[model samples]
Target: MKLKRYLWIAVCLIALAVSMLPAYSEDFFQHHREFRRFLQHHTGFQVSTLGALNVGVYEAAATLAELKSHGDFGLGTFEGLDGEMVVLDGKFYQIKSDGVAYPVKDNSKTPFSAVTFFRQERSLRLTGRMNYQELRSQIDEQLPTSNLPYAIRLKGTFPSLKVRSVPKQTPPYSPLGEVISQQQVVFELQNVQGTLVGFRLPQYLKDVNAAGYHFHFITSDRHKGGHLLDGAFLNPVVDIETLRDWQIMLPSNTAFEEASLE
Candidate 1:
C-alpha cells in the first residue's frame, strides 16, 4: 500500500508540472510579442517622402525633427535643392556646393528624404581593394533577395573618394538632371575616414525611388561630404539591414500635387 501511495504522489507531481507548462509557455510568448512590437515601433524599417522623380518639388514637406522621430540614419536633400543630406547617428548634416558639411537645424526642411532607425542585422568585413562597381556586385551577392529595400552603411578609410553636391534652386526649379548638370559641385578627397549612408531599392521601385544604390558621404570630422559618384574602399566594415516595411509620406503642398510625376 505504501509503495502504491508513493507511486500515486509521483504521478500527481508529474501531472502538476505538465499542467504548469501551458501557463509558462503562454507567458513566454506574450513577452516575445511585446518585444517584437517594441522593435517594430522604435526601429521602423524606412520612411521616405515624395518620389525620386518628382525633382521639381523643391519645398520642405518634413522637418528634421519630424524625420528624427521616424529614423536616425538616412540621406536626402534640403529644401530648395540646398545640398545633399547625410544623416548619421541621429544628426542631420548638409553638404553644400563648397564641398563642406554643416549641421542642419531641427527646423530645417527636406524636399525629398529617406531615413531609417538603423539596426544592423548582418555585417561583413570587406578587405582588399575594390572599386564601386565591384563592391556593389559583392554586396548584391549577399542580399537575401532583390525584391526588398536595404540600408547599407560602410565605415572605413578611403584612399580615393569622389562626391558631388548641388546648389540651392530658385522658383521654377529645374528637374534634378538639369540641376545636377549645371550646378553640381564635385569634391575629391584622398586618404580620409568617413561613413557612407545609403539605400538599395529594388528595380520595381525605380519610378518611386532611386532603383539601385544611392549613397551620400560624410567625413568623420563632419566637415566634408556629398553625393557619392565614385569611390574605392580600402578595408571597410559593411553593415546592412534588410528593411521589410516601407512608408512614403506624400507632400500636401500644391506643387507636389501639380507636378508631373511621369
Candidate 2:
C-alpha cells in the first residue's frame, strides 16, 4: 500500500510538471504578452458592439503592429453566437442591428464612454478575463476576407464579367506557387441595350485577403460617366472586418455583379 501510494504521488508530480511544460504555456503567454505590449504602446482603443443576436465586440487594444493584427481581438459569451459586446479603454460601444461597429457617433465624436453608452441598457458587463481562442475564432468568422468565394461576388451591370483563366504567376517566395492560376476579368459600362461606354480591368491586384486573394480593377475612362458605371464593379476592400461597419465602401475586395444607380 505504501509503494502504491508513492507511485500515485509520483505520477501526479509528473503530470503537474508536464502541464507546466513550455509548449502548453507558450501560446498562451505569447498572446498575453503581445496583448500587453499592444495595450502598453497603443492606449487609444475604442470598445464597440459587433453583432445583433450573437454580439461580439472588439477593443482596438493596440495599433497595427502588423496589419494582420487588425484581424485579431474579440469578446464572446457563447459558442457559435456572435459576441456583440466589446469593451476597450473602459468605453462601451453598443452593437446595432446592422453588424457594424459604431463608436457612439453622437453629439461629438468623443470616443464612446462606458458610462454613457451603457447607461440606457440593462445588460451587465462580462466577468472574467478575455478568451483568445473563442475571440479569435469569432473574429475570423466575421472577416469577409477569410470566406472568399461568397465574400467576393461580381454584381452590377458587370455581373457577367468575363473571367478568362490565365497562367499563374510565380512569386519569389513560393515554391509551388505556380500551381495557382489567375483570371483576367474585364468590365465595361454600357447602356440598357449594352452600349459600350468604357472598359477597365487591371493586370493585377495586391493582397485581397478573403482567405488568400487580391483584386484590382482598372477603369478606362474616369473623366466621363464611366466612373458611375465602370466604377460599379470596383471596391476598396473585399474583407468586411478590416473596415468600419458603416464604411462608405466595403473593404478592397468587394466586386459587383452589375451596375445600378441604387
| TM-score leader | 1
Candidate 2 per-residue lDDT over residues 174-251, each given as its tens digit: 211222122222234332111111111112211111123222221122111111212222221121212112101111
Clashing pairs in 1: none
Model 1, span 1-262: residue lDDT tens: 9999999999999999999999999999999999866555334333333454356788778888988988889899888989999999999999999999999899999878888888888897777898898889888887889998888999988988999998889988888888888889889999989899999988988777788899999999999999999988876688998877777787768888787666
Once fitted onto the true fold, the runs of candidate 1 whose alpha carbons sit more than 4 angstroms away are 1-55
RMSD of 2: 22.6
Q: Which runs in model 2 stand beyond 4 Å of their true positions?
A: 2-12, 15-20, 33-262
lDDT of 2 at 169: 23
Evaluate all candidate structures by whole-model CA lDDT and list the values in order: 0.85, 0.25
Highest lDDT: give the candidate number.
Answer: 1
Q: Least lDDT summed over 10 consecutive residues: which range in candidate 2?
A: 111-120
How does candidate 2 score on lDDT? Answer: 0.25
Per-prediction TM-score to the true structure, in the order listed? 0.84, 0.17
